[model samples]
Target chain A: MKRSLKQFRYETAESLHIALFQIRANKIRSFLTALGVIIGIVAITMMGTAINGIDRGFDKSLAMLGYDVIYVQKSSWSTMGQWWRYRNRADLKTSYTEAINRTIEDNPNSNLLVAVPQMSTYQASVQYRDLTIEQAFALGTSYRYPQTASGDLSSGRFFTPTESAAGTMVAVIGDDIATGLFGEREAVGNIIKMKNSRFRVIGVFRKQGKFLGLFSFDNQVIMPLGAFEKTFGKKGFVTLRVKIRDQKQVDDAKAELLGIMRRIRRLPPQKEADFSINEQKAFKSQLDPIKNGIAAAGIFITGMSLFVGAIGIMNITFVSVKERTREIGLRKALGARRNTILMQFLIESVMICLIGGLIGLVTSFLMTWAIATALPDFPVQFSPALVFASLVVSVATGIISGLAPAVNASRLDPADSLRYE
Target chain B: METSPVITMRDLKRHYSMGEETVKALDGVDLEFLKNDYAAIMGPSGSGKSTLMNIIGCLDTPTSGTYILNGQNVAEMDDDELARVRNREIGFVFQTFNLLPRINCLRNVELPLIYAGVNPREREERATEALNRVGLGDRITHKPTELSGGQIQRVAIARALINNPSIILADEPTGNLDTATSQDIMEIFSDLSKAGNTIILITHEEDIALYTRRIIRLRDGRIESDKKQ
Candidate 1:
């Protein structure tokens, strides 16, 4: 057994050497054969990178929504397109935050932490001095709003609870709003006009990127609820952002909130509640089918390329076996076992594919780098796991493609093969 | 001189099916070779000399009867076992001096020991020594494409000798060489035979057969005569 193992090791080494020599000798043929694998691996890796980028971008957007917070709103975020289902529903009142907070304070074992109310409009415009910024988002929330949101203040502070209760006309602006209105000037203590209502900029949020490349978080102006009501009226969309005690217990928290909402709505036992409780997970569920569709289509197309590549390798290997029939005969006559010949051909094809995979990986990496450099906002990430998966795929392709030809080469009749012209 | 037989064959038969007809390639051949015996098998185009050589070299199996080489049954062995027997007990030199043209002379000569599972260091050592014995020691790194017909044939002979097998089987070893180069190859075999190695030569040329100690002639598929030189 030891001797046979040694023999196998030696034979494998010899086969590898032969494979290298063959590839080097037939450089052009080998490269052309490997080109198919190169294209396949590039397609696979690029597709994987795109999917990874989408996942990363989605996660980043979800983080902006705050994982530990759930929202009580009129329309469900998951079925956002079919707003008609919620058109006749009563609007969620900002006053529900007080009732939810009272219920949380009453129940010691409640999964709820604290609730904060938010009111927002996307059509609001802000003006300072001679410049006016249009379509700036305007949000109204309480002093405890920071506990349920993601951004941090780069300067100044959020409105105090006393100021919030007194309906002070102070606004905390996003980085984009600060930079746009102030432009290298300090934003804090400066009064900005919105809908003819004057407001002092008390704080500025640090820059946060767009959410799913759709909504910009860095373009909002946040003010106290009462001040927003005075400026834009009380008819704006309302959301109750409730912070949970534990993110992992979000399902229990949602259930608890659902019951609290039903009680608050004073619905009969059989009548459905008018409000929808939504979390970041609803957005994820909504996007999942679309993401999966992209992935499935990408994989199917890439798999077809890999399949074509494998066939190319197989055809080239068959030709190689036929070309070296005399060598196979000689090796056998010199006492090489059937498996030795088989391994030689297999190693040759595998070497070709492995080289191709490496080249493809480098090419994809460069292309991704170029894309990321040219368009920094476009999501394209190359992960280490993708590298590993593509290499494994290349080796598997080589084995699958080389099997039949290698077997055929190994089974050739030595006597007749030697006599072959 | 009486010596123990290194190879023994008893009424060996080899048959092949060619469509609807059965061609008896080898029919009722009985032969023996003692230790260090130098012999030549002579036959016409249709004779069974090639079939006999293949069976003796363990490249093919007989349809019936027993053949023994180095006290192991070659007739009943499976493919892998036959491979092992070939690696251990027989070395084959082909007509075309089938050296893989891309590899150097030393690598070509080391082919048999590679199959025999010899380590690289020792395989190189033994292959060098065999090439030195065949008078091409200085051309160890040269490829077959760079060598003369006689030198390539000599590299083949070195390969045949690398394993120190029980018998060296040469099937038309000088068939592709000119008269002068053939004589040079025959002289190397003559020297090897004198060094106490058993050798078998298959050739149609009487002049090449005359160099061996014993000659066996075949007609159709049976031995016509066997005579000592």
Candidate 2:
């Protein structure tokens, strides 16, 4: 038999045409065979899209905490594997925060560390003239708090440091809070009552969207720390929010704050400091292992789906070889080489996989869109690299599945094949 | 005999082992065919006519035989070499035509050259020429199912002739065709033979056997008689 790549390609293409025609002829059978592949791809895609969206959401949440800014909290914010242990600790006291503020004030080099106190309650009920909204969260912090609340200033101005120092009763409201307290009217300078204590709204926060059916940053009230302490009586203890000048100095600053707090509290050197220090980056780091686990699971399951698809392709190709035995004999008798036969069938198998994979890829993109719509915080990132990877996988499925059958077809004895019924 | 015989076989034997029994399909057969010879082998069922034809066409190798085809020892040739010889020196036309149903006439005719490693542009040109030679000039784009039985046979013949092989092997070439179509195919065979191509056919039909200049009869896995018209 004359053996050339050109002839092989031509015959391969011709054979693939026949295969497709056969598939088209048995539409229901072909569709049913592809159904498993379709379900697998869609399930994998949807799962992957959802997980990827969450990962992106996590990233956006981190982004809200500016990369250039370094946050210092009383407790280490990372809750990896020991959430209960951290949760059981006694809350850091307000006197510790006052001492930390004094320490930062006294040291010119540490003056970049802005010390602020926080007092928050999630079950607070608010009343605006006639309407009252229950289960609203109220936040009380120093005037410097808005600088850390990146999404907390949608309208009007944050309260000035002078007002906070003097313990003025000014608040920053979230969009939902503003709507509940002031209706459509401008909320700046409006007074809203929380726990029968009235406070003036200075700013309304931007909408931060929803997560798992819960409203986010746009539904809370932000008040100055001094006024919060006066009205709420500073009873539940306070967390010191410290801003560092440079992220590189966070470790040194943390050590300094712990030392100052310990000295002020007059604790012995052997005793554990009564506070924890936290960083936003550490919080993200805590979430990484879970995301990685989810990612690995997705890949493995998706890989199995592709394997199943390959098996389907091989089965179909084998059937095709059986059906075309006479044709194979005729071609051989006409001088088709073994390699030519092999290439033809192999290409046909690959084409089938390519078609299936292409449909899967398109469906995955659509699923990505749905994911983005539902969880806007999640960034469902679809990179060209992923597209390339999927295509490679599909092609690999084709080559691997089609190889044995194509070889079988190529090795067929012309005499036997011609005689095949 | 200044010119060597194109095919020569000595004591050619092919045996199939069916469990504990060995059935001799071709037993100690000796044969020779010169260049441009038009011949036929005739026999009843189980007479080994098909087996003999397979060995002669290089589609099967005889056990314990010295078979020299065109001065090359065919028995010693590997699978690739045998395939090459089959592609370059022999064209086979089955009784059923066996044209691929999905491909058009031209592509069917081009099958031989494809395995022969010809480029596409030349393959198309040569396939077109071969199809036209078989009097299928206009129906080159029509598929096998779209053509008449005689046309499909012609397309098969065109495919067989694509590489301009020295020998054309027809295995019960008219077994599936009606009398008229069979006669039409026989006429094409005569034309091919006249064009200096050696032709060998295996058939049981007396009428089909009579078309060739020579006839060899096989009986019970052995040559019974050989005669020239």
Candidate 3:
């Protein structure tokens, strides 16, 4: 057994040497054969990178919504497009925030922390001098709105409770709004016009990128509820943002909030509450299927390219076997076993695939880097796990493609092959 | 004193089916060779000499017969066992020299030892010594394409001798060479035979056959004559 093992080792070494020599001798042919694998690996890695980036971007957007906060509104975030089911429901009242807060204060064991009312519209237009910004998200909320939202103020401070209650003409502007109106000048103490009303900018929020690449948090103008009511009327959409005691205990908090909301709406236990309670998890559940669809399509396309590549390798291997019939016979007569010949061809194809996979990885890395550099906002990430997976896939393809041709070479008749011209 | 035969064959028969007809490649033959016997097998075309050489070299199995080589029953052995027998007991020199053109002379000669699982250092040492014995010691790193026809044949002979096989089987070893190069190769064989290596030559050329001590002629798959000079 020991002797046989030694023989196997020697044979394997010899086979490896032969494989390298063959590949080196046929450099152009080998590269062409490897090109298919290269394209396949690139497709797979790029798709993986895109998917990873999307996941990261989604998580970032979700974080912007505040993990410990849930919203009570008329329309459900998860089923956002089917608005007819919610159209008949009574519009949520901004007064619900006061009622919810009172209920929490009365109950010492309540999971709810505080409730802040928000009213917003996407059609608001703001102007400073001759410059105007359209499609600005104009929001109205109390001074406690900061507790249920992300992003700290980059300059100045949130509105004081006295200012909120007095309905003062003051506003907190987003980074984009500040930049659009004031440019290099400090935004605080500057007055901007909204419709026929003039409001002083008291604070400027830091830049936060788009939400799932759809809505931008940096394009909003926030003010007190009384000031917003004076500028845009009370007909705007309302959402009651409720902060929770702990993010991990969100289910308990949501159940408690549902009871408070039902009592506030004066609904009996039998009737379903008219308002929908939503969290970041709703967006995740809604987007996961689209993400999975993209992944499935990417895999099918990558598989097809790899299949073509395998066929190319197999065809080349068959041609190699046919070309070296005499060599096979000669090796056999010199006492090389059937397995030795098989191993030689297998190693050749595998080496080609491995090299191709490495090249593809490097190419994809460069591409991801270029994408990240060219468009910083575009999601594209390359991970070590992707590198590892592509290499394994390459080796498996080599083995699968090389098996039949190698077997054919191994089983050739020595005597007849020797006589071949 | 009597010695055990190095090779023994009894009632060897090999048949092949060519479409609707059966071609009897080898029909019932018995033979034996003692150690250090230098002989030539002579026959016209289709006289079964090639088939006989193949069976003797352990490249093919007989349809019905017993062939014993170096005390091993080669006829009953499987493919791998036959490969082992070929590696350890027989060294074949082909008509075209069969030296792998891309590899150097030393690597070509080390082929058999590689299969026998010899270590690289020892394999190189033995291969160099064998090449030196064949008068091509200085050309160890030269490829077959760089060597002359006579030199390539010598490299093949060196490869055959590297494992110290029990019998050196030369099938048309000089068929591709000119008269002068053929004589040079024959002289090398003569020197090897004198050095106590049992050799078998397959040839139709009378001059090549005349160089051996014993000659056996075949006609139509049967031995026609056997003589000693």
Rank by TM-score (best first): 3, 1, 2
| lDDT digits (tens) for residues B98-162 of candidate 3 | 98999999999999999999989999999999999998999999999999999999999999999
TM-scores for candidates 1 onward, in order: 0.96, 0.91, 0.98
Rank the models by DockQ, top first. Answer: 3, 1, 2
**Residue-wise C-alpha lDDT for candidate 1, range A1-421, written one tens digit per residue:** 8889889988999999999999999999999999999999999999999999999999999999999999999999988989888999988889989999999999999999999999999989999999999999999999999999999999999999988888899999999999998889999999999998999999999999999999999999999999999999999899999999999999999999999999999988899878899999998998899899999998998899999999999999999999999999889889998999999999999999999999999999999999999999899999999999999999999999999999999999888888887
For model 3 the TM-score comes to 0.98
For residues A19-77, could you state the per-residue lDDT of candidate 2 as single tens digits?
68766776776665554456556656666665666677776776666543444344466
Chain B TM-score in each of the candidates: 0.98, 0.97, 0.98
Candidate 1 is graded, for docking, as medium
Over A1-421, each residue of candidate 3 has an lDDT whose tens digit, in order, gives: 9998889889889988998898899999999999999999999999999999999999999999999999999989998889998999998989889999999999999999999999999989999999999999999999899999999999988899999888788999999999999998999998999988899999999999899999999999999999999999999999999999999999999999999899999999899879999999999998899999999999999999999999999999999999999999999999988888888889989989998899999999999999999999999999999999999999999999999999999998889888878
**Candidate 3 C-alpha error for residue A420, in Å:** 1.6
DockQ of each: 0.76, 0.57, 0.79
User: Given the true complex, what DockQ would model 2 score?
Assistant: 0.57
Provide the interface RMSD of candidate 1 in angstroms, 1 decimal place. 0.7
lDDT of residue A73 for candidate 1: 94
Model 3 chain A: worst 10 consecutive residues (lDDT sum): A412-421
Report iRMS (Å) of candidate 3.
0.7
lDDT of 2 at A411: 97
> DockQ: which candidate is best?
3
State the displacement of the C-alpha of residue A86, model 1, in Å, after optimal TM-score superposition. Answer: 0.6
